[model samples]
Target: MPFRPDPSLPVPPAGADPLPLQGLTLLLVDDSRFTCDALRLILHRAGARLRRAESLEIARLHLNCYRPDLAIIDLGLPDGRGEDLIAELSQMGFAVLGISGDPAGRDPALDAGAAAFLEKPLGSVAGLVRLIRQLTTGIGPVAKGEEVPVPAGDPMALRDDLARAARLILAPGDPAYARGFVQSLARASGDASLEAAVRDSGTPFDRARVARMIEDRLNRLRALA
Candidate 1:
């Protein structure tokens, strides 16, 4: 199918570089609003027009209306697995990048016909840009003028991550869920100690210890003026 662009989507900034992905449109299909926001920040700064759909149905709607140059799909969607969508988009000839928090999902994503598989929570925006450059144009940096200087730490995203940690700590339902959140949050916060604590936290006692650790860290972050 020939690519189509949505008129309602905002174009890249006027002064932005027109190389790399300057004229391309990207669709991100993921359930997490926070993650979609992060992708928007990264891709928009890198010169691509961004559109987001939070579920598989919403993504289908976007596909029916407008065809994007590329789509980044999250495997564990609320409604359905992203692998299915990747197969469909692949059949339709769009370059699809499959992303997942679970490491085991990578093979299935590639088997479903994704051009590449990425693990999340991503290390940095620069990694994302580099992946795009590698995927689209073989080998090169982000094409000079298209580079966006990513900060060492984004206070807002970190704050949201902390809030999530607090909630997970407070209402511990599934151990796997809590453990997964701890891993992702730890990565986002760049807290190696916490990451090790959570990774080693397998037994009930360990989980309780991690919960206290999370609570303490959250409290410290909250108390900061």
Candidate 2:
């Protein structure tokens, strides 16, 4: 008779198999540590390995040595616009996906040769899993009927988001450089008041408004902390 199975080995939970992304690897490019944390958990559950880079410069460094199967880039990186990086990655043959809170940024991301665009606050784990499968493997999403976990909203992360935006606001020159990042930061952090405050921060003569916004938001963030 054939060798029988071992009776005491461990087993994965139900619906854990059929992982469509079994051999795929992904890179997440975003400045928000919290956003990365959330996405990391989602991708892991989907059976895909994740690599992270917080800025364009760092992402370039990662690209020099390792190539992921897919790259999901956030438009608002600290060093540069992710659209610019997408062009280079597209040229290198990576299946690239772009994500942003600003609709305007989405078009530029696509123009730079991203495979597709995903709106921010990615929200649900099931939606993300399905999206990656559809974008990378051209296969229907697996585990459609299974339970999908939700990512937690981290207050500390939200505070960091405000801190980063405050730095950009205080620095002179053009706030436009960080406008997209700040807006996305507010949205993901669930701070609607701060979002409205940064609305015109990129325009000249709005320094007072921006400054006031930052101060107010900082107070709230500190309390949350």
Candidate 3:
């Protein structure tokens, strides 16, 4: 389906082109529906088409069918690190943009050959558009003092992510993937307590505590629903 900008979301900078990315096709490799939902709005405003793959496996499957004009990869994935995919795609001459909720992910992503990197909770549509334009064309000049508006992800999507994490935390076996997933979500949502709980969780007791916290948040979100 074609992307359509949400009217309730922020508009681009006053002088910016409404359709700067027209005729462009983008592939987003990410797991979080929250992130995908937010990017959908941004891409729609910029007049771009989007296809999504939630993991490296899925992305490779997509690549086998067709190559997109650009690929925006999330540094963390459920199956593997996004940098590995970035290295392969960049070597293949694809324009790649790496994004992560963890600021520390920047260097590894860039070193892996991503054209550019953006920190997550990706607030600014104009900033993203500018970066995409520059990556594809090597030229995207922003007007002086223009205030690029920042759009937020859908709250329900966030709720869904938390709910999934809540389930993962309780599931038997190592919770490494869930921990990283929650860490990313915590950073994106500014949930410092949740972030700390997951980051410092090294023992069974700590893991149980983190599970409780996730469950509490999930319950609250369910209440709202």
Lowest lDDT 10-residue stretch of candidate 1: 1-10
- The list of candidate 2 runs beyond 4 A from truth reads 1-20, 146-150, 202-205
Worst ten in a row by lDDT for model 2: 1-10
Please write out the lDDT profile of model 3 over residues 160-181, one tens digit for every residue.
Answer: 8988787776677447777778
- Superposed Cα deviation of residue 185, candidate 3 (Å): 0.8
lDDT of 3: 0.83
Q: What is the C-alpha RMSD of each candidate to the true structure, in Å?
A: 6.1, 7.4, 2.1
lDDT of 2 by residue, 17-112 (tens): 545677787888888866766675566655677888888988888888888889999987767789899999899788999988776777899999
Error of 2 at 215 (Å): 3.9
User: Which of the numbered candidates is closest to the native, going by highest TM-score?
Assistant: 3
Give Cα-based local distance difference scores for all models. 0.70, 0.73, 0.83
Output the worst ten-in-a-row residue range by lDDT, candidate 3: 141-150
